[model samples]
Target: MNSLRLAAGAGPSGRALIELREVWKTYRMGKVEVHALRGVSLAVAEHEFLAVMGPSGSGKSTLMHLMGCLDLPTRGTILFDGADISSLKGSELAEIRGRQIGFVFQTFNLVHTLTALENVELPMIFQGAPRASRRARAVELLERVGLSDRLQHRPNELSGGEQQRVAIARALANDPKIVLCDEPTGNLDSAAGMRVLESLRDLNEEGRTVILVTHDAEAAGYARRRVQMRDGRMVEAAEEALR
Candidate 1:
């Protein structure tokens, strides 16, 4: 609702929309260490649709969490619009993440009792946006995702596809620079999954950077490019995006 300011020319050579330079995520379980990600570097251009594919325990989700700013790398730097995120702490990182990024989880993380409109408005409300604007933006995003008629329906009142749509709408409510989705269509039927993929593709065409993580090949096919990971390392899908 705040007039989505999707970044343009997202890359280092131009102006990286998102950059992870030599990223690593190592977690220690007592004396044993678990390395989820290892020295991964990636750059995504503005509006690029990238599908992150990997088997379970392959660190796709960990990498996604780092990109979403939900977690920090143990030994690397992630830059969002040229800002070094690894240097920020607690409240600072939270503010930037809330203001700049949107996340869509595999599970439809919607309030069961709240109306679709209310659920969609949650992020804007968190961002300290006015109540009226939150309502208006939520409505606009629901419409964008073809859920205009279901605005008054609660999560249980909607189908799985519909609930995911609301979740997607909520992700876009704040007009974030990047929309990060983890297994967005994993819980939907094939037809419903297709519908969701279409919506994501449409959003990407509308100039929003979409970074989706999926293990399904059919799901990843919707993206413009695909990046595969194995043993916590990138498999060299293609050249880094520039400009």
Candidate 2:
């Protein structure tokens, strides 16, 4: 693996956009409780590309869910843009997620019949974005992610990499401040995976906060920083990121 910083540091802009303080997540699984996250604290700066690594049983997905506002932590504070979000209700959290965050999932999650342009425009349609503006923005994002030629193509008409790129374009439809991706390239072959990574790297370089969750070191290499987790706790490595 490359010598990526294993902690938070500077970015395209010197501002911290996401902060997790003493974050904890507990799951109630029958009589036994599961500690999915164990008091983890970290800062992800604006426009930074961060990779999270852990084994299957590790709390990587749990952390990503909390970070993406898909789930609330059982204990601790999550501050997005300097506001505490761990206490927000589901609706409030949804609004925050819709307005400020973008998600790229392992599954492309595209509507089978929707064209790439329509799939990308769904977010805005839900958010009540103006028709003209949403259409223009979706096209722009598709182009930005190198999908201009495929805008009118449906997911079934595209390749795996193209599908993921369309998903990315859709995620960016709201012009989100940060993008949270989960095993984004895990479904593709090596060549396709490389294309997806390059797309993510390009997005990060162009000033979008990019965070990826993956078990693959090769995938993590695309990030400027990597965070390792194990058994619900962050296994601190020697300091690589400048404190």
Candidate 3:
């Protein structure tokens, strides 16, 4: 856990890449209503590695989804690079997500039928990138995540760690500046999870802003700062140097 560095006294970078202000999200499950977030405010600076830790049903995933542009806040504002995006329609948000943000999930979410390379190239394909260029970038990203040797393997053929590596590579396919991960290592063994965490740390060190949502302290150890959530609200924050 010593690898975790805290960004103490690090004020806002004059420009936060993501800013959430009094954001609240509510879900309707039949006649029941679920308040997933409660007046949560946060600011994520450029190239910062932040971990949001909370128990199940603590709204960690909802917060991640809001930051990733997968979902908008039910109330309040979300600003991306200072522009309000809280009310953007699905297509507009999708555009922002495709070009500006990347995502990794606990499930790895790889196309079981696609090879690692193809899975990594899917984002570029959606952006209409040239085939040759997409292939080269996908290869480069896979190698960056230490998955060069697994290029042709399908998700089913790879180990949990390998699949997660491929997912990381895919997240970088669009060259996004921000990466949002939700319980990324939740499904892996200790050794495998370490690999995933190291890969994420490398990405953060390379200037990509990474937001990790997880309940595991060991996994959160890879981050420089931590925000603890409880009952849909951020209750604690800390930053410490990695020494």
Candidate closest to the true structure, highest lDDT: 3
What tens-digit string does per-residue lDDT give for candidate 3 at 47-80?
A: 8899999999999999999999888888988898
Worst 10 residues of 2 by lDDT: 1-10
TM-score of each: 0.90, 0.89, 0.93
TM-score of 1: 0.90
lDDT of 2 at 178: 88
lDDT (tens digit, per residue) of candidate 2 on 67-137: 88898888888888878887678888888788889888888889989999999999899899999999999
lDDT of 1 by residue, 1-243 (tens): 110111222333345778887788999999999999987877777778888899888999999999988889999778887889877888987886777788888888898889999999888877899998789889898998888999999999999999999998988887887899999888999999999889888888888889999999889888877788887888746324431
Deviation of model 1 at 110, angstroms: 1.3
User: After TM-score superposition, what is the CA distance of residue 120 in candidate 2 from its true location, in Å?
Assistant: 0.4
Candidate 2 clash figure, as a count: 0
Worst 10 residues of 3 by lDDT: 1-10
- Model 2 C-alpha lDDT versus the unseen true structure: 0.83
Top-scoring candidate (TM-score): 3
Alpha-carbon error at 73 in model 2, in Å? 0.6
Question: TM-score-based ranking, best first?
Answer: 3, 1, 2
